[model samples]
Target: MHIKERLFGKTAGKEVMAITLTNRSGASITAMTYGASLLEWSVPDKAGKFDNITLAFDNLEDYVTHRPFYGATVGRVAGRVAHGSFEIDGDPYQLETNQETNHLHGGNSGLDTKVWDYQTEQDDQEARIIFSYLDAEGSNRYPGNLKIQVTYTFTEDNKWKINYQAETDAPTLFNPTNHVYFNLHGTVSKTILDHQLFVDADRFVELNEQSIPTGRRPDVAGPPFDFRTARLTSQATESTHPQTLQVSGLDHPFVLNHDANRLDVSLYDPQSGRKITMKTSEPVVVIFMHNGASPLKIANNPIPAYAGITLETQDYPDAINQAHFGSIVLRPGETYRSETTYSFHIE
Candidate 1:
């Protein structure tokens, strides 16, 4: 395995660096210091042809202007917090409502937009990059001083692993995920409708019109919600179910039936014969069939809706308010850790 670093661009007067880690098998993953975002992942298909499978911009200017969250490390909390209001040890804290009335993706200036310090390590079997950031206390009105580290490991066996660790100086909320959209066909011009997906989940979090959880975990026994078995993504995007129609596709958080030894999710594209299986320690995986309404472009071409999909593994959204969703609270003297791994191969 080997690693290379190059100047990506300048953002906020700080130089952003792009670090590429290549394994012996010829698969490579590139990450950027800006937002600690994933820049590219090129892997071979059945024909031994390599292509970038993640949807991302070709330059830093687009990332700075569009803020699509593409491949970025989402943080503080991965999903929406109801009205940006939550209490920590009886003290109520209100965050910026960046998305309508909800606090989406850790407020306006979340971890995804921050530049992080990084360190790299390489061994005979793996290449690793660790990005670290310090979230000052009271930033965006959140409590505690949070020190977070996001590590990406590329192994010789074609496994890309993400490990998140955090520590807080006071009571705070911490749930993070990588917003990396994958289109196995290798291009954003192609939609993921034809890809097959399997999620080991019996239920999914119900969301309101505003996309905040309704505190309900609806059973996914039939139709669009049922992805227990491998099914075409078109099955969900083309469905008329209210939940599917609400957001134009599957954007709900499916509560995982966790098993340390089992792979919890898999996505495959028949045409390219590229498959990715995921295992995570987190309790939920938010499957977002990219139904972006923004006028976006990549390679100077217009990006269509459903061009890619995200499998965001993290704790439940708005867990602080939903008693059954479990806790995301990180207090002093406590350390928070979560991990997710993706193994790639030809089907």
Candidate 2:
């Protein structure tokens, strides 16, 4: 059977209250609409016993008071924008930037900070939840009255389907993605260094220290940034390499090998015999591995300092500013549509 939960604090209006997704193996995935955040996800291990695979805080206090942006939905724009500024139609616009100069995760008050309209339903082992929000013309200092709808469905087959759509009364740029950390071998393990990762990408955008694309799409072959073949991820982070130092791990987007329809990206854990496959209609996907920092720094998790890797699917990081890059602009009367799915299967 499917279950639903609703929580509200007299002071806090419309908390996630409850999530209604089933665990195919009798496990559970508890989500909250608070940040449109994922609070709990239960996945199986080698012993056929399911465990909470992602690292997350237990309560709203932990989420609100301390670490957020972990396992939560980030919006407006997902990655970083150089110098917290961009030019659209030759107009220069600057945002309230973070991380010392870059605009990280939309802005100071991104989509995670807004109150979303919650629509949910359940039947038998299947559950569906939809989160919608309206953005004013200058809410984030961006243009247009934008309406976005995100539908999350938990299937009996153990698939987490995410479908996103948006329409604007005026012209604006849009990019949204879920930032979830995964450790198939369980949390508290040291590095995902040994796990095998395969990305069907032949090229990747190089980034400057600010995490903004340098507008150069380099060949992924022979460089440390290469993941064309299934290889150990840590190889890209050796002592003498470029993909190593900038805040650590794989945080860059891979220009996919397949078209912008459905493509499969896989990660396998030899220790647990578990596998994760990521599918999306988007052309760019960012793979980020947690590098272990204090709770005040990054998102809190129950891992050995650095124990998870994040698979974030989206359009390019800073597309609005880069004309050479793909288009993120949603014009009037045009609807933007995209879908990404994260499915789990056993070996």
> What value of lDDT does candidate 2 attain over all alpha carbons?
0.75
Q: Can you give the lDDT of residue 79 in candidate 2? A: 90
Each model's lDDT comes to: 0.91, 0.75
Which residues of candidate 2, in runs, are more than 4 Å off? 8-14, 123-125, 259-263, 296-305
Best by lDDT: 1
lDDT of 2 at 271: 79
What would the per-residue lDDT of candidate 2 be over residues 220-241, giving only the tens digit for each residue? 8775667767777776656365
- Poorest stretch of ten by lDDT in candidate 1: 292-301
